[model samples]
Target: SQQGEEDPQALSIQEGENATMNCSYKTSINNLQWYRQNSGRGLVHLILIRSNEREKHSGRLRVTLDTSKKSSSLLITASRAADTASYFCATDGLNNNAGNMLTFGGGTRLMVKP
Candidate 1:
């Protein structure tokens, strides 16, 4: 089954500020990943947290997963105008895990002003 819902469809912040997004999924997920998209172009993977992982961080990016709540969150710090883009959360689970079918969240649009 398909699952994953992102909160706050849109957000606006200053260049030096920070942006945070949340995601919720319905099924049992093996892992959760965060991606960033510039304009309307392709997406770039930011971070991935396994179901067993509670939190992970990469540079300015931080991700947290709570299987108990079937939810996850992504945080981007020290934002820049170049960071303006859309973010998405993807879940890998069941018959649709990894190389199989991929389910993604609705996505959150972030606008960072210089």
Candidate 2:
């Protein structure tokens, strides 16, 4: 089984600043996914890039992948107060008993102050 690990469990940034977070995985994966949780709410899928892709961008979110290193990074540009939430990365592997499942990291809590 594979699991995701994130660094700097928490972060604080100004409304207009950029927020960056990193995630590492313990095993090979088919794809990596980034999600955001608004306080006590369920996670919302932020982005999903395949293993072969290097970088992906969606609005203010940018994700980078390094398959050789088994690591990924998420960058949130021009933050806003609404962006304050817990971000997590999930690892997806093909060989699994439960079909397509995601192993989530502890998460990085981001606080965007106005």
Query: How would you encode candidate 2's per-residue C-alpha lDDT over 1-114 as one tens digit per residue?
Result: 338888779999999999999999988889999999999899999999899999999999999999999999999999999999999999887665785788899999999999
Question: What lDDT would each prediction earn against the true structure?
Answer: 0.88, 0.93
Q: Which has the greatest lDDT?
A: 2
TM for every model, in the order presented, reads 0.92, 0.95
Query: Which candidate leads in TM-score?
Result: 2
Q: Could you tally the backbone clashes for each prediction?
A: 0, 0
Local error of candidate 1 at residue 72 (angstroms): 0.5
Give the runs in model 2 whose Cα sits over 4 Å from its true position.
none
> Model 1, which residues run further than 4 Å from truth?
95-99
